[model samples]
Target: MALRKIVVLIYPGMHPFEFGVTCEAFGMDRSDDGLPVYDFVVASETEQPVPTLNGFTITTGHRFDEALDADLVIVSAGARGGTPAAVPATLAAAHANGAAVMGLCSGAFPLGEAGLLDGRRCTTHWRDAAALAARFPAAEVDPNALYVLDGRVYTSAGTAAGLDLCLHIMRAEHGAEAANVVARRMVMPAHRAGGQAQYIEAPLPPAGSDGLSELMDELLAELPAGHTVNSMAARVNMSPRTFARRFAEATGTTPHAWLLRQRVLLARRQLEAGHEPIELIARRSGFGTAALLRHHFQRHTGVAPTAYRRSFSAAGPPV
Candidate 1:
């Protein structure tokens, strides 16, 4: 179905950045860029003014009634430290009607209140993941994911991850070409998978780990070529078994996993920059064949290679 109506539910103590993510994705007029225009509205329980987390106030003229028939209903973060304030029942009804429901950051709390998250895989900010799960035992909360989607309900981690989920929805609904236009206008990455880790904070390695860093850099630079644990260990002048253990300690991920991610990242960069044949990109990105590239690319990004390129390429839309 064509998505045309979007309603963002706002509450007291709403964070401006969280609210703006929805507005930037759907409220802006992008018809000039050949994108679809949505009937976007910021909704509240009452039409009264709502205080923001930024020490300011915002007023929306719409109420819960306005969201009853919306194609998508988005819950914005509330004030009380990721614990939502009173949520309207209309949100539950909208979900029952099969409208796409999304929760941005702490917004997932309201969905839980509405009982929309029961038996669903959802996620919130890392800090609140445990709380959300504790509050709603039926919900499966994944703290590491950037976002989560079970059926039509969507939830994201803190802050900018909301933008990622929004763009993914746009891409899925409107196709890659249309989503790419909006992403380009906003100057954001066109796609980020829901399965990606929420936070990748690794402090500087200890003094002796410098060698591993240099070795990893070399491996990254030589991604288009064949690599194995033994080969990498030989390059680093260490036993393969010892290299594997040290590599995991330094990178916090296995070598093959790291290589796969790097290759996919490189392939996506090339895909987004220009019109390149998928096979050529596959070869350059070290996937060896278009089929292999497609397998890993889809596993990582939740979209096929050609579709991904079509979503972000500067040339005309994907065929």
Candidate 2:
């Protein structure tokens, strides 16, 4: 059998985790596993040393010309919007040549810029999810998804999510047994459905005053249906203006953002358990309507409530 070539794109300010994931998954030698061998190489847009966020550097031995010839090409994520990726000519060539392509983390930005994400379902980190949605309204963006496979193009939610997608890819290319062998060697999970949603919620700060703390916890548990900001502020015996400022600084995010994440988390547990219909889930999770639950659920997990339940395929209803 012919050896499958795997080429990974290493850009400046590249994430070590993302690149390491590719190397660990596809770049290792596994001839003894009776699997088709992979010829893996790290190539760069330029021949110079690639800088990383931790101030370390990795030198690339090959360039775009060699990378474009690979059967699989990976674009890795890095600092949020810091490293401006050059849509290297080799990437277009790789796509043109019919190679399976993938974008991980902020790596999706470059792919989007190269028109790779056009007319395809994709995902990125939740922090940049809103921006991606706003930027590419026509393109379906799932910020909360661990990864998304749209035809030949595969995109993962954030840096860690890359591992999930790679293992998923291995399962597809080989099978459960093969994927398990590779995963066991790496001390990672062998199977996480590509459609499994991402759980990225910003934690709220502990309440300063006793009265406010109790109220805050309840509000989080019962989100949209809970007390308003003013009501919360009154519970702590403070003005709404003062309370909002304190809350923002304490939580490191606006109340609205924090609340949305908490609510989404609650809804995910319920959806996975297959406890109720969309309307009940929406009401209990504080979204108030099925459409509202779906909007946030889709934003966070990359799939609708019904789809999420169906993906489980366990004996009983969702759990």
Candidate 3:
């Protein structure tokens, strides 16, 4: 579906930064890129100024009525210990009317209250996932995912994951080209796969563990070379089994997964730099073949290499 209208529901104590992610994703003027501009409006329970989670206040100048015909209705970040009395019905109606309904962070509570999350795979910020599940016994809550889309209902982890969800929506509604334009304008990765576990900052290893850190630095520096779990374990002078356990504890991901992510990052940088052939770029990024590069690249970025190059290569001066 082409999303032309969006209505964001706001409340007292809502986080402004989270609200801004939707604004940044849909409200921006990107006509020069030949992208569709949405009729984005912010709505509230009342027209009165609503105080934010921070000290300041904001005025939406819109009412719940604005959501009736919206293509998308988003519930922004807010305290979700309880659902706002009037919101659940409005959100339920929007979803039933074929509008895509989304919840950012704790906002999932309202969607849950609306009975929209029932039997659907959904998520909230990891911190609130348990509460959401407990409150709505039938909902399938995925605590580890960065975002979950079940039918037209979407939910995401805290703050930045809202942007990831929005980009995903854009890609689904428009195409890779439009989403890439907005991502480039925002200076963010057009897509991020895996899950939110990678974003949660784990406690650091002991101070004496600097050797592992140094080894990781070297691995990143030499990402163009093929890396295997066995080779990496040898580099750290440890048995493969021990290395795998330690790697998981430290990075929240396995060695192969991390290597693929790094290679994709390198490939993206190369694609943005100039009009290099996909085969050469693939080999330089350590994928060794254009087909392998295409598989992983599209898996992560949602666009094929040549299409990504065409979308970005001539858009600006060489980096």
Q: Which is the leading candidate under TM-score?
A: 1
| Weakest ten-residue segment in model 2 by summed lDDT | 310-319
Each prediction's whole-model lDDT (CA): 0.83, 0.75, 0.83
Ranking by TM-score: 1, 2, 3
**How well is each residue in 44-151 modelled by candidate 3, as lDDT tens digits?**
888789888897988878998888899899988788765567788899998888899999988889899999999999888888988889999999998878888898
Candidate 2 TM-score versus the reference? 0.67
Candidate 3 ranges beyond 4 A from true positions: 194-198, 201-319
Q: Taking the tens digit of each residue's C-alpha lDDT, what string does model 1 give over 252-295?
A: 87778888988888898889887778899999999999999999
- Misplaced by over 4 Å in model 2 are 1-3, 79-88, 202-213, 216-319
On a 0 to 1 TM-score scale, where does candidate 1 land against the true structure? 0.69
Residue lDDT tens for model 2, 1-319:
1228888888777778888989988887788888666888888767788888778999977877766677878888875554444543566678888787888887777777667778989999878888777766767997667889987778887766898898888788788898889877877556666666675545554756445567667786567576567777887787988888877767666667667778887877777676577899888888899998888877766667777666453435434
Please say which candidate is ahead in TM-score: 1 or 3: 1
Question: Distance from true position, residue 198, model 3, in Å?
Answer: 4.1
